[model samples]
Target: MKEESQTIRTKLAKIRFFSPEGFFVCAAIITVIFVAMEALGLRSSVAVLAGASPGAGAPATLGMACLYLLGYLAFVVLAPIFVMGSIFLLLVNLITGIFRRQQRHF
Candidate 1:
């Protein structure tokens, strides 16, 4: 029981959502979805946001278009920013730790 609990804790600790790798993976997945939506011509449907409602034939198209737009903004515009921010934070932490250790020795 003790060993299993320790393993679970380690696994949980390894799950870092704000890490650079995690951000990149999330960005890549969102990009793929955005590209797929664009390939299917959902871009035109998204223009409904400008000043038009989806027609009676497909009410769901409006919802899908909105979702695609949100995904595009999130993945394309925000993901890289998050990735860079995480990297910067990690580097700062590393440098600070090194400085602290050096100070401790001096």
Candidate 2:
């Protein structure tokens, strides 16, 4: 029984939400790219989010531009949100690992 409990505790410590972490990291990277495009004067491409440029008053030609910009902003925000969520999960996993390790030590 002791050996079996030890094995279980060690196994639990290695477990993690690896898939979600990978996805969030990827999304964050993509967001950074979109932000870069917006920075480099690619407004039209970034305006696809809100579908309109109500605040900027960029004119009809820039409508699409504004929409794309909004899109980029949305993605940028979402990426961080996802990354944060992943980080939270990581913390939870770490906590559980620690608990299991402590339990096994006895």
How close is every model to the real structure, measured as TM-score? 0.61, 0.51
Clashing pairs in 2: 44-65, 46-68, 46-69, 47-66, 47-67, 47-68, 47-69, 48-67, 48-68
Candidate maximizing lDDT: 1
Q: Write the per-residue lDDT of candidate 1 for residues 1-106, one digit (tens) a residue.
A: 9999999878756857776556655666677887888888777877566657545236587787778888778877877787777688688879999999999999
Compare the candidates by TM-score and give the number of the best one.
1
lDDT of each: 0.74, 0.66
Candidate 2, residues 28-103, lDDT tens digits: the string is: 6668777776676667443434545344454654665755656676686767777877778778879999999999
Looking at model 1, which ten-residue stretch has the lowest summed lDDT?
Answer: 50-59
